[model samples]
Target: MAHWDPRGQVAPHVRRQVASLAAAVDELVVVSTADLDDDGAAFLGRHGRLLRRTNYGYDFFSYKTGLEASRPEDFDEVVVCNDTYVPLVGYGEVFEAMAGRPADFWGLTASQRVHPHVQSFFVAFRPWLVGSQAFRGFWGRMSPVSDRASVIAEYEVGLSRTLTDGGFRFASYYTETDADRALAQRRVAWWTLHRLPPPRRRREWEFLKARSKDPWNPAIALADVALAPSPPRPAGARLPYLKIDTLRYDPYGLGAERLLRLAERRRPEELAGVREYLAATAPLSAARPDTDLRPTPVGVRPLRRLVEYGRAA
Candidate 1:
């Protein structure tokens, strides 16, 4: 898994997540951009090889680095995922389901908004497709750039286009429905009507109660779906993983309360991990920061040493 943490330490939820996922794969490789501390590195090292790289091209480069070091061609299937979501169930079931499907590549979910493509957050590629020239050529051209938009456009979405043109097919595990669209749009609209800024935690949820629940923000509803899963309405809907984007960014109005409800109802096994993740990310306020800009370093001196990584990202 491609991993990053500002604290240079693994979160409790991620530790549990990695441990559970370890059983589903023959090998586990964690590529981290963060300069992990000794305990963090040792914990991850226990599972499999742990690599540290510069945070250059975001998660895709981390995926690239891991694949290069691990010899992906030797494996029957290779999965590229980031720590962007927390799987509520064990990956054994997810792998079991994907193995029965008939696609060269498959992901957790796909989106139709920006051409027909699988969201690249979590994708598994079959060996046949992985060995093809199209697969190699795509990665061969990857370059390190800080701008995320270009990475998504050229690599994330580009990979699907390249593979598809080469006669390889791709699929998604969680296919969204018209009902999901209605629900996602409604979710966006609810937050839009309330006009909530970036949310930090459940304490700010008081605004949700005080705000309108009309779900009729036409402009936002018409905006492209943010490629996130909607919250469970009936409360037991099948979402294989709870997207961290939904909770941390709240782009889809899928917050802690809905997730807690789902976990409390059916998947209590993951309740503790889910709670820790939520509390860690949940901010005390949605208020914007007053001083985000930082002053440049003096003389560009770091003890006469320079560390540059991901130059080929």
Candidate 2:
């Protein structure tokens, strides 16, 4: 598991997540970008191998560092997940459910924004995919780009495409049926309409959007059900996580609260620490202003032949 907090403090929910995940795997390696307190360090130490890296790259940077350091070739399965979400359900059911599935690799959910690909947050690699030359080359090609778009295009989307092109099959755990997908499309439209600015401007914004697609956003276009798990869950809608990003940066205002509320209603026992973390973080802003950023080591990763990429790396 890869975890990073800007303030270098570990929240109770995060700790619980890490510990809970630790129990499932034979070994868990946590690559932390931020410094941890003594208790945090001790807790992680008890759970798994803990490595510290400079906070220059994104999650994938930690991914590269951790994978290289741990030597994942020996493992039967390798799961790359991060602190970007809170898992509403524990891993036991999820793992058990997915065990019989025939996918060489799988994720909790998949999105069809630009194309079909698994969301990067919770991907599990079976030994078939994990031990391949493609797997090693994938990591070697990774350059933790500073921007989200490039990262998505290169690493996130590139991952599934690369593996698929290599003849490996992938699957999503909570596979949405045709009806569920239609519901998501409708929900997405509702969210886009409601997330508009106040009345007069909302009219203008609606008019503009009706004609132009310039402001079409990744989050908006990517209609994952985590962003819209309101009311009745569709059949087979057993996604384990509710993204923390949706809690803070819900650009569409598309029912992140409803998702949280649903989790609370279903399983309040697991939510106390999540609530505490939310209180500490104070998720008041829906969107963040574009801050001037420096070019960091965290960048992009593109797919390439093993031999060529090997020399480049």
Candidate 3:
């Protein structure tokens, strides 16, 4: 969840959405920052089986922390969600879509023009893909977003390139333009010797915000919320048949059954024996992602050292 720093009325709404989502899943793990107050903590405790909080950072750092927290062992599938989205139905469908793929690569619900970068209402993790030190390091390097727009675009492009280089496909349930809207809003929060004059700063923020044409002020929604497609799959990308095995319920014979139902566009519950079939399967593994990469030193010292070595050589 990319949480705002101050506590306010937003807390109650965020809590309700989370509670509803937790009830739908078999096991839930909630990760947030210290910004969550007593009410937030109590709400989360009731819904999540496990809860973790990290160092407070802005939207960028908080997002990076969540990425780092995901492990191959936590669940067969990991769903990354922004706090703003309220899941109306089972997200199990997403995992079912990504079933049998590598764990490291992400399965996302995509939006038009703007790819779902900073926040995704739905993302699924495959285990094998996530087990690489290189992948984790790649994400770690993206911490503390310097430029929101460019950072988002570059990360998605770079991520796609890296995954393709490593021989993996990025999958998405595409969304249309009408389903999403984005707005930008900036105001002078501080002044400094190097900063622009107040009038100029205000004008700049106003122009950008207007040009973006967001449905509401960017601060109101944090430019993260979007309408999830009903049935959750967009046109033209539907497979002939895709199985959505409920890992929590049916583990054994459901794969074949799921495949059969998917072919017919039928929900599993509509089938006669699926419920019984799912109840008998055992839980899957919960393993951590590989973290073997050497951490990169922060700042220009490493670059300076490299330059010195090159000159000496």
Q: Judged by TM-score relative to the true structure, which candidate is superior, 2 or 3?
A: 2
Alpha-carbon lDDT, every model: 0.64, 0.66, 0.39
Per-model TM against the reference: 0.71, 0.77, 0.46
Off by over 4 Å in 3: 8-13, 24-27, 49-60, 63-70, 97-108, 111-121, 154-158, 175-313
| Cα RMSD of predicted structure 2 | 11.8
Q: Model 2 residue 205 lDDT?
A: 64
User: What residue pairs clash in candidate 1, if any at all?
Assistant: 143-313, 144-313, 200-282, 200-283
Q: lDDT score, residue 195, model 3?
A: 34
TM-score of 1: 0.71
Instruction: Write the residue-wise lDDT of candidate 1 on 1-313 in tens digits.
Output: 9998776878776887789868789999999998799999999999878988987898989988998998898898999988776676468777777787889998877665445666787889999888999999888888887665677677777888888999988877664457545655445434433355533678666664444343332112221222123453222223466555444443433333544454445545554565665566456323323212223235422311211111100
The candidate, 1 or 3, that scores higher on TM-score is 1
Best-matching candidate per lDDT: 2
TM-score rank order: 2, 1, 3
